[model samples]
Target: MFHGLIPADRYYAYLSFRDIESMPNKENVIIIQTVGAVEQHGPHLPLMTDAAIGLYIVGKTLEQLDHDKSPTIYVLPPQYSGYSVEHTSFCGTISLSASTLTNVLMDIGDSVYRAGFRKLLFFNSHGGQPQVTEIVARDLRKRHSDLMLFSIFAWDLPNIAATLVTPHEFKYGIHAGEIETSLMLVILKEYVKMNLAEKEYPPTLVPDGGLLRIDAGLTYAWMTKDLSQSGVIGDPTEATSDKGEQILASLIASFKKLLLEIDAFNSHV
Candidate 1:
C-alpha cells in the first residue's frame, strides 16, 4: 500500500485500477506477470516457496521504482501452478502439463495486451516451466512485436549469484539447497523445521561415455524418482536468515535496474 507517495496516516488506504488510471502519468504503467509453482520443496520448506520469492523480488523492485519516480509497474497476482514434470513424484507437487501452461500464459498475455500495457515482463522463478514460458514468449512476440516482453528467472540477475554465495556453494546449489533453504528461512521461517534438514545425491543414470549430450533437448527427462529418494539435493542445515537477506538485497538492486531499462526501452520502441 505504501508506494512512497502517500503519508503514513493515509498509507493504510489502498488504490484500485481506476485510481491508477486517474493518475497524471497513466501512460507509463508497466505490468509484471509473475509465474511460480505449487510444488514440493523438501520437508523443511513450504510448497509456496517459488511464489514467495517471485512476489518478494517484484515487491522490492516496485518499492525502489516508486522511490525513483519511475514508471509504476503493477505486480499482477502470481500464477501458482506451472509445468513441473520433474517434481511429479512428490506428494504435494501440483503442476500443469506443458501444453496447459502454455495455453494459460497465452490467454493471460492476450488479456494484458488488450488492457493497453505497452510494456510487460513475464517474471518467473520456477525453472521447470521454461518450455511453456518459451512458447508463450515466442508467440506473443510474433503477434505483438511492438510490445516489450521479457521472460526471466530471478536467479539470472546480474552479479546476483556471485554476490549471494561462493563458487563452491553455487556448485551444490540445486533443488532444496542452501540458497532455497535460506530464502525459506527469511520468507517462511515458521514452516521450516531445521531438524529435518538432510542431503541427497542420487547416482547419475546418464552414461559417462557419451550419454551427456543424448536427449539434451528432452526437457524434464529426469523425474524426481530418477534424481533422489528423499527429493532433496543439497544441505539445508546451514540455511540462515542472514544469507537470505543478502540474496534479497542483491536481487532487488539487479531487478530495479532491469525494470528501469525496460521502461526506457519502451519509450523508444
Candidate 2:
C-alpha cells in the first residue's frame, strides 16, 4: 500500500479512478457519485453542463485534498445521462423516468459496495435526481450496515456563495441562476455564451413548487419548467469567473470536513 498520500489526483489510470486496485488504502475512501441530467441549461449553457461541472468540482476538490494531505479522496466518473423527464419537452433535454434513475443508483451502489469501498458519497449537482440518490443511500445504508452513504449538493456551500454574490443573487437559490452561471464560467467558459443568457421565472401558482414527502407517497416533485419560464430560475447575467473560484473553494473545504467526520464515524464502527 502507498505509505502516505500519493500527491496524485488520478487513482485509476484506465478508468476515471473508480477501480479497486487504484483505490488508496486510506480509511473510508469516498466513492463520489456525480449525478446530473442531460437537460437544457438555457441558451447559454450546454445540456451536459451540470454533469461536467459536478465532475470538475469533485476532481478539483480531490486534487486539493491530496495536496493538503487532508484525506484520500477518489473521483468517480460522472453519470453523464440521468433522469430528466421534466425537461423532455425541450429540444436539448434528455430524460429517463424516475424509476430508471433509482435503479441506476442502486446498481452503481452495489458495484461500489462490492469494490471494498464502504463509504459512498452521492455528490449530486442536478436537482431532478435527488430522490433517486436519496432512496439508494437510505436503502444501501440499511442493507450494508458497515457502509456509510451520503448525498450532497455542490451548491449548498452558502458561505462561499455569499461572498461571491450580491445580496440580490443570494436570495434566489433557483436553477441556472447567478451561482450556476458563474460556476459554468469557471468550468466551461468556452461553452458559455453570455449574450444569450436570459431570465425567465416560472408561474408561482404551479403545483411543482409544492412540498414533497417520500413516506407519505410523494416520491418526486417539481420539474425544471415548473420553476422558470425561459428555463432559468435566477439571473445568469451576473455570473463571473471570480465567483466560480470561491464557490469551488468552499465546496472543497466542505467536502474535506464532511469526509473527515464520516471517516471518524466509520473508525468506531
Candidate 3:
C-alpha cells in the first residue's frame, strides 16, 4: 500500500495515491484507471489522437463526479502506452507487448486492492486494450475473490452515437474515421487538420471480406498496411465539432451509469 499524500493534478494526471487512500474504505469507493495509445490517426488527426480522446472523457467523467453526492470514485492518472503492436506498422505509433501491458495492469489492480480499494474499473481507450485488460481483470479476480474489478473499452460506448455520423461512414469508420475525427474536433480542435481529412474504405483482410462486409468482425487478424496505406479507415472529411460534442456527452452519461451500478455491488454481494 502507498503511504503519505500523493499530489493531484486536475488536467494531465488527475487523481493521486493520497486521494484514493483518504477516501472511505467502502465498496462505493472505486479507482477508475485507463490506458490509451499514442498512434497514427491518419494525416488529419495528430499522433496522440487516442490519448486526447481517452483523457478528455476521463477528465469529464471526474468533473461530473465532483458535483455528484453518490459514490466516491477516484480517477487515477491515464497511461499512454497500450497494446498497439499492430499499429507500429505506421509511423508515430508506440506500443508495448500484450504480456507487458497485462502484467502491468495486474500489478496495479493488486496494489489498489491491497490499498483498501475493493472496486477497480479499468477504462481503456484503445481497441486492443479491452482484450488485454480483460484478461488481467480475470486474473485479479481469481487471485482475490472479494475484489470487484472490470475493464471496458471506452470507445465502444460511442456505438450509440452512430446517428451522429453518416450512415456510410459509420459502417466502415473503424479507425481514423468520421467518428474518431468528430470526437477529436471537440476534444482537441488544434490538433485536427480538416484540410488533410480523407476517406478510405479498406478491404477486409479476411477471405471475401467476411459476412455482411464487416471486415473487422472477421475471425482473423491484420495490420494497418492490409487496410489503408494512410493508416486510416472510414471518412474524416465529414466530421463536425457538434457531432463530437453529442457523442462525448453520451459517453459521459453512459460512464456515470456504469460507475453507479458498480459502486452498488455491496447490496448484491
lDDT of each: 0.72, 0.71, 0.76
lDDT of 3 by residue, 176-220 (tens): 998889899998799899998988988744445336454345335
Write the residue-wise lDDT of candidate 1 on 87-151 in tens digits: 98899999898888888888888877766666667889886776577678889878987666788
RMSD of each: 4.3, 5.4, 4.1
lDDT of candidate 2?
Answer: 0.71
TM-score of 1: 0.84
Q: By descending TM-score, how would the candidates be arranged?
A: 3, 1, 2
Model 1: C-alpha RMSD to truth?
A: 4.3
**Per-residue error at 41 for model 2, in Å?**
0.7
Task: Name the 10 consecutive residues with the lowest summed lDDT in model 2.
Answer: 1-10
Clash tally, candidates in order: 0, 1, 0
TM-score pick, better of 1 and 2:
1
lDDT of 2 by residue, 11-115 (tens): 432345444656567336766777877888888888887887777666665656544665556655567788778777678787877787778888888887877
- Evaluated against the true structure, the overall lDDT of model 3 is 0.76
Model 2: runs farther than 4 Å from truth?
A: 1-27, 166-168, 206-221, 267-269
